[model samples]
Structures are given as structure tokens and as C-alpha cells.
Target: MSRIILHAGMHKTGTSSIQAMLNSNRDSLRNNDWEYVFLPKDAKAAYGYIHSSPDSCTYSEAKKELEGIISGSDCKNFIFSSEDMTAALQSEDLWVSKGERVSQLFESLGNIEVLIYYRRQDSFYESAFQQRAKEGVPLNFKETLKRLPIMSSMDWYSKFKFFESCFSDSKFTYISYEKAYGGIGITGSFLKYASLNDIIPIDHSKSDNASSKILTKIFAEYGPILDPHDQSLLSDVLCEYERAGDFRRYRLLSLEDRLSVFENYYQSNRNLYSICENADVVDLDIWRADLLNEYSNDYRNAVDDKDIIIDLLKLISATQK
Candidate 1:
């Protein structure tokens, strides 16, 4: 019997953590009849076996390698994960490119089960901004989003719907990150999702924590503003920093602004979960109420008036166009 579990992530949803667990616990999981299968060394690392830039020759070779692993192993369960599959965007038509990746993947792997986690819109935007900063986009939350419309679109329902059309046969299980946190936590929830809670131990000792590298990307992006010597020295200092850090994690968008974005996805999210439009899975209403009660007009955030001014200028420039 052969079984495949594809954990395609919707960025910023603890994907690196889940992939780390799979990489570290491979042997232990193999003992439990579960295998974290391999693709090309680069593909396994950067993207789930699905390549970012797809080619038939590369995917074909990978398919051969994967089939060999499946043939030799007695394990009934296999996992391959890379959430950036649907998350990352380079152009307006991400679906065509990513959808091609999925099509190539299905052609290679044959019948397989796919699992994806859908994160709420507002939280996804905040966390994704941090990720973009890692890739050396130093703009603030609002600006980065303005540049990346696919991200700002917050169109999870349409993306997932496309996935359904692409891999319609595979068993689909949707995990709510908010719901998962309130219950068995991330790793625990994954094990439960895989039905391996009793089989494989949830060990995260060696999980990859890539957050530390954000400073390097940020400094690199600011290279034009720094001298060569200063840039090198800054890199050294950033690497040794005692703690993980990102752009000051302050409120980037106003609550009213965030709510407006959330409204775009309200019906989409409800459609995904088969819940009523008024029901909140992302807890926006609850989070909004609590935040409003905690902070007053006197509460100042780290976002500077200058940054707000820049945002306004950008908006003004856009409207004129």
C-alpha cells in the first residue's frame, strides 16, 4: 500500500517548523511506517518536490528517485512539505505557474493525499510582511503589500478552489491554524492530521529556525545606503545578536484598515469551512474588540509619522494614475 501526504503551506503558518520535524524524525518515523520522502536535494530544501521553476526533465528524474524510495520502503505513509507552493508570488498569474507545478507533481507522484493549512487574512498579511523583509524587501507592511497584489488580494478561497480543481482526487484536509493552536498546538496537530500521534514521537529538537537570517537580508537590501565596510561589519553583528528579531513587531495597519481587508476574505473563508458568513474562524472580531479595549487614541505605535506619510504619498500617486 502507498500513501502520500503533501503539506503545502500558506506562508507564515509554522511551515519551517513542520518541515524541520519531518527532517529530524525521519528515522523514528520510518520505524512507525511513515517516511518523509525525498526529492532533489535543492527541491526538498527550497520547495516541496514541486520546483519553483518547473521543467519536465528535472521533475521526471525526481519522479524516478521518489518511486525508488517508495518501492524499497515498507512505510505506508510519506510526507513532503513546502507551504510556499501557493504562498509565494512573482507575477500576476501565480496560479498558472503554481498550477503547472501541481500538475507536474501529480503526473510524477500519481495518486496522493494533499493537506494544506489556510491562515486568516490579517495575521497572514502581518507574518508574510516579515517573510518579505527576509527576502530583502525592506518596505513596511502596507508598502510591501501594495507592491505584491497577489499577497494583498488575500484570496485564499480562490487559490484553494484552484487546488481542488488541480488535485481533485486527493483527500483534502484543511487545518485552521487558530483552531489548531487552541487545541494540540502545531506539531501535535500535524501528527494528529497524519494519524501518527501514537506512532511517531513529536520531536522538534533540530527543527529549522530561519528567522535569525532576516537581519542579513534586511541589511543586504539597505546596501546602497551603507559603505562596504559597514555592510560587512553589520552582517557579523546581526548574526551574533542574542535573540531573533524582525522589524519592530508593532501594529502596522490600523484596526479599521485591517478590518476592511478581512471583509474581502470573510465570505471566502466561510465558503472554505462551510460555516456561516457571520461566524469567525480567524477570530477577527474577538481580536479586534480586545485590541480596541486595550489601546486608546493615546497609544502610539512604532510606525513613524514619516512612514505613514510615505504610505499616503504612495496612495496618492496610485489614485492619480
Candidate 2:
């Protein structure tokens, strides 16, 4: 019997890193007897289908692409990874009912397993806010953080009951971004399920790209520090910056500030975390601490020297390359 694994992302959870590694090591994965089907421009294809279909939330075009992949390949195991799936769930109204869509999609596949990763609400909201700013959304961190409910509403488990209803406990797994690297046993368990085993080398290269809380604060306060003409170029480079887990310069809110923010979303955030805990999702305490540590370290090591600006400029230039 064939196996189909669908890795639907909850976003801000190292999705890009995983996707990049998979795409970069496709040959190795194939040699290990696994067939990987990655849409060259998965986001474009996903958005194309989403925007084009006014009546359906399901990306029929993307689904068609999946159909072609399944039909064209004879591999017994197939993997489909995309963070957009989580977005789709969040905007459930845009798609047909969740139950209907899941049933229809799964009917076309063999035995299927669903995987997702969850991040802490506070951390995800902060990072997502920075990301929105980079994308031309003129939202400051405060405004972005204030919109947590709207954002968290889109997470897969939060919006779609179909995923839980359709798949057994054993068929679904949730991982935390905190345990994402090294010879981590958590990652080992995840890979074991995919049957990738030890055939693939662990990716030790730290993510150079990923939103830095400090950098985000800097941009928020000073406006685009990079050359305006290079905004587009810098945006490209910063795309991966979110994965770097580099949080040097970002200061955590004071106890009062943290309490205030938590109070604002007390019920909602609690419920969200509760759902994750119930679903066996790994907690993100470790990751949150790591982010804070990086932020503090960056702030301390930050220099007001011209060399720092020069380095930033160089990073922008590299993005254009």
C-alpha cells in the first residue's frame, strides 16, 4: 500500500528551513526510497489557486498539481509540505466546509498522515508582525501584536476540526520549533515516521535569514534603514532571516508589559495553548527562551559603529545577488 504524508505548517515554525532542506536534498531522499514532490513555487501556486477561485477555499489548481504528481509518480510514499495549508484553515470561510474538503482530498490518496508544528503565541505574533512590516504592511509591533486573535484564528487545529476528526491520534503528530536542531531526539522521532532515517545528514547551518526582534524594533523606530531602492532586495534576503533564530537586540517586554499583553489575550491564548497541549504538541518554552536570549545578546553586542551599517548594507546587496 502507498503512503501519503502531508506536512501542513502552522507558520513561523521553521517551515522554510524544512522545505529548503528537503528541496536541497531531494536526490538523497529519493535514493532512500522516498519520493518528494515540491512545487517549485509552492506559495505562488497556492496563492494563485486561492485568489483565482472565488467560490472555493480549496486550491483546486494546487490540488490538480498534486493529482498530477501522484499520477505521474510510482513511488509508494509521497510527501506534500506547505505552510499555506494553515492559512487556508484560518480563513475557513473562504473554502468549502472543512469536513467536505478534507474528505475529498483524502479520498484521492492512500493512507495519509498529517504533521504540524506549533509555536508559542507571543513569539509567533511578534515574528509575524515583523514579517508583515517587511512585506509593506505598515504595522508596528504593538499594532501587530494587538491583532493576535485574528492571526491565531488561522492556525490549523484552531480552525479545522476536520483534521482531528478525520485522522486518528496515531496518524497525526505535532512538533515544537524549540527542538528543531542538533542531534535532537524529537527530530529523530519525526524523521522516523517519514522513514527518512539516518540516511540524511543533520543540517547544522544556522539560518542566516529570519526576522530579528531587535532588527524589527530598529526598523519600526527608524523606518527602513536599508536604502529605499534596495527595499525589494533586502526583503528577499530577510525572507530567510526569520529562520536564523537570531534575536540579538530585541528586548523582551518588562514584567508589566508582558502581563498586560497576556491579559489582553488571556482567554484566547490560553485556549489556543490548551488545544495544542491536548493534541500532544510539544511545548515551546525552550524556543521562547532561546529567542529571548538571542534578542538580549544582540542588543548587548550591538555597536553604533559604521561597520555595523556597512554589514547591513552588505546583507542587502547579497539579497540582490
TM-score of 2: 0.66
lDDT score of model 2? 0.57
**Residue-pair clash count for candidate 1:** 1
lDDT of 2 by residue, 29-91 (tens): 777667776533643444445444464334576677666666677566777776665555545
Alpha carbon lDDT at 43, candidate 2: 36
Q: Candidate 1 at residue 177, lDDT?
A: 72
Give a tens-digit lDDT track for model 1, residues 37-153.
533453442244454544334656655656666677787767877665665443337666666666565544545777777677776766666555544443555556677665756
TM-score of each model, in listed order: 0.70, 0.66
RMSD after CA superposition, every candidate = 8.6, 6.5
Query: Which one wins on lDDT?
Result: 1
